[model samples]
Target: MQTTPEHDERMAKMTFASVYPHYVSKVERKGRTKEELHAVIFWLTGFDDQALQRLIDEKATFQDFFDQSNLNANAHLITGVICGYRIEEISNPLTQKVRYLDKLVDELAKGRKMEKILRA
Candidate 1:
């Protein structure tokens, strides 16, 4: 069946509105700072003032914002899987303390095995 452009537009708008609510609330509430809130929203929905204001009214959390965002579910799932793997790969107190990417690279250059480098 052929779908009209109007039908497609309506469907897209509905989807965006439905999904937007969840993210808005989370970022509004749980984001401790303006930048933090903006960053999360920017990552999720680009930047829309009306949507952002709605989220502020509702208050939101990081997970909530992520759950509601327009990001593809399968993509999010795949990313979650990869993140889990990365976390497992780098699950060491010493490695956790390395806040900078450069520090991580430097540690990697020490000629140490993955396990040893992560531990250090």
Candidate 2:
């Protein structure tokens, strides 16, 4: 998907903490636990619960959040569409990383097994 400068700027400016609760709600409403959400996050971004909480507390933007992460090598295995953009085809590195997390959360909420979600 083509990454527009404006969209990239907007996403980069958006705080992770602002959207975190929505992610929690999405997974929980699907009967998934917050632990499960954290597991997915850990698999994709290598942040444990404590680090994640710290990031949230810091009000880090999407840019800052990914900047501090050691993105999993297997993150490339996350493919498909999210928010109308194909994950593998996104041109912006930061935007792609954000969508990678989004796709992982989506898979978890959709009842995909953890092993598959983590690409294990």
Candidate 3:
């Protein structure tokens, strides 16, 4: 999947609140807990339960959400393919960050050990 500027723009406009439930459901359906999902999210974005709830309430766009994040230094360690894009090779920083989150959730759903998934 080639990520054109149009695709990036669409992704940037996506609301965190909109996709959050699907993330929760994806993990939960695979027997992962919401706390585990939260852990993954926290590791990537530094947003806790309260802050996440606030973002959901405000319906923050992905751009706004990531712009406010203190992205983890280890986020660079998140390398792999997500949504058909290789995380490390992605040139768009925000899109890479989004894929990083997706990849983390995928790992969680696959029952990967938390230590490895968080690149600990």
Candidate 4:
């Protein structure tokens, strides 16, 4: 396996809602706005605030949330290192997607202008 078996055990069962607040908190702590965080999320997941809220409200798992939402056509454009793992190189599809969001949020937290985060 290109990634470790533990990677599956690590994130296969994580809930989108469970990790979402941390994303928000991390960016907000960096003096970034919630709207910027939401923008990156929407850019990747194709969910507006309401749909995302519904999924979070229902406590959707990462798999469930992604299975239902349309991944952005441009999400592949987001590529970088996050938490020491290259976003484009993570072999597990789910973890890669999750980390893609993480990278976007990290960029937002670092104040990497929203346009660049959105790949605009």
Candidate 5:
């Protein structure tokens, strides 16, 4: 059977909610905000307003959307989208995870155990 472009487009239009009803309900029960829901949809299938709205109407939650989005397939893109979306939610302004590494080194000079110093 020959597949038409229209058929492909039609299939593409189907949202994750329609494909995974059980997971969608689980996401809604988790109390995910609309922005988070959108982020997940955007992460998964790119941006499609109609599809996204359908998922929202079907009660798609953050976890549901995340689960459907194959983040591993496009890790960098997904990470960028999620981080950009939640940038404001980060309370700490520290740029690095090891912000106090320098301080730890200074303390270690005073005879602190290497394990204890590293853990600080």
Candidate 6:
């Protein structure tokens, strides 16, 4: 099966490490902390601190990164509009998953509590 090029460009082929700094910056600039950002990603992906660092250092592609993830069951609880797309309504499965992570990080940057962001 083939995935969309738009999806490939938007996120599929992007390296997690390449985009990670921006995530840290976005949250820290908003008065949040890197720990919170890490926590969000960890919660979503089931990666511990060591595993996440390893993935980043390896420059894993978004597809590779997610392929290694044991996505949390509660991830389905993440919903709402992001970047003009309704999270739950995204047609392409990979795009929807990527957007789900993006939406969580966005919420963290916007100052939502970690527990709430984790859907706890």
Q: Would you list the clashing residue pairs of candidate 3?
A: none
lDDT by residue for model 3 (1-120), tens: 558898889889999999999999999999999999999999999998899999999999999999989999999999878888988988888888899999999999999999999899
Across 29-118, the per-residue lDDT of candidate 6 in tens digits comes to 999998888889988899999999999999998889999999999988999998777888776766777888999999998888887999
- Predicted structure 4: lDDT: 0.85
Q: Between candidates 3 and 5, which one is better according to TM-score?
A: 3
Candidate lDDT (C-alpha), each: 0.36, 0.95, 0.93, 0.85, 0.38, 0.87
TM-score of each: 0.25, 0.98, 0.97, 0.92, 0.27, 0.91
lDDT of 1 by residue, 1-38 (tens): 23345543343333333544443454345433334434
| Best candidate, TM-score | 2
lDDT of 4 by residue, 1-120 (tens): 156778755676788889988988999999998988888888898999999999999998888887877888888998878777887888888888888888889889998988888888
- Over 4 Å off in model 4, which ranges? none
The lowest-lDDT stretch of 10 consecutive residues in candidate 1 is 74-83
Instruction: Please list the residue runs of candidate 5 whose C-alpha ends up more than 4 Å from where it truly belongs after superposition.
Output: 1-17, 51-73, 76-120
RMSD of each: 16.1, 0.6, 0.9, 1.5, 18.6, 2.8
A best-first ranking of the candidates according to their lDDT comes to 2, 3, 6, 4, 5, 1
Q: Which structure is stronger by TM-score: 1 or 5?
A: 5
What stretches of model 2 exceed 4 Å from their correct place?
none
- What is the per-residue lDDT of model 5 for residues 1-120, given as tens digits with 9 covering 90 to 100? 223455334434444455444334444555433444344445334546676666668666443444443332332221111212332232332211111222322333344454443332
Candidate 1 displacement at residue 41 in angstroms: 3.8
User: How many clashes in candidate 4?
Assistant: 0
Best by lDDT: 2
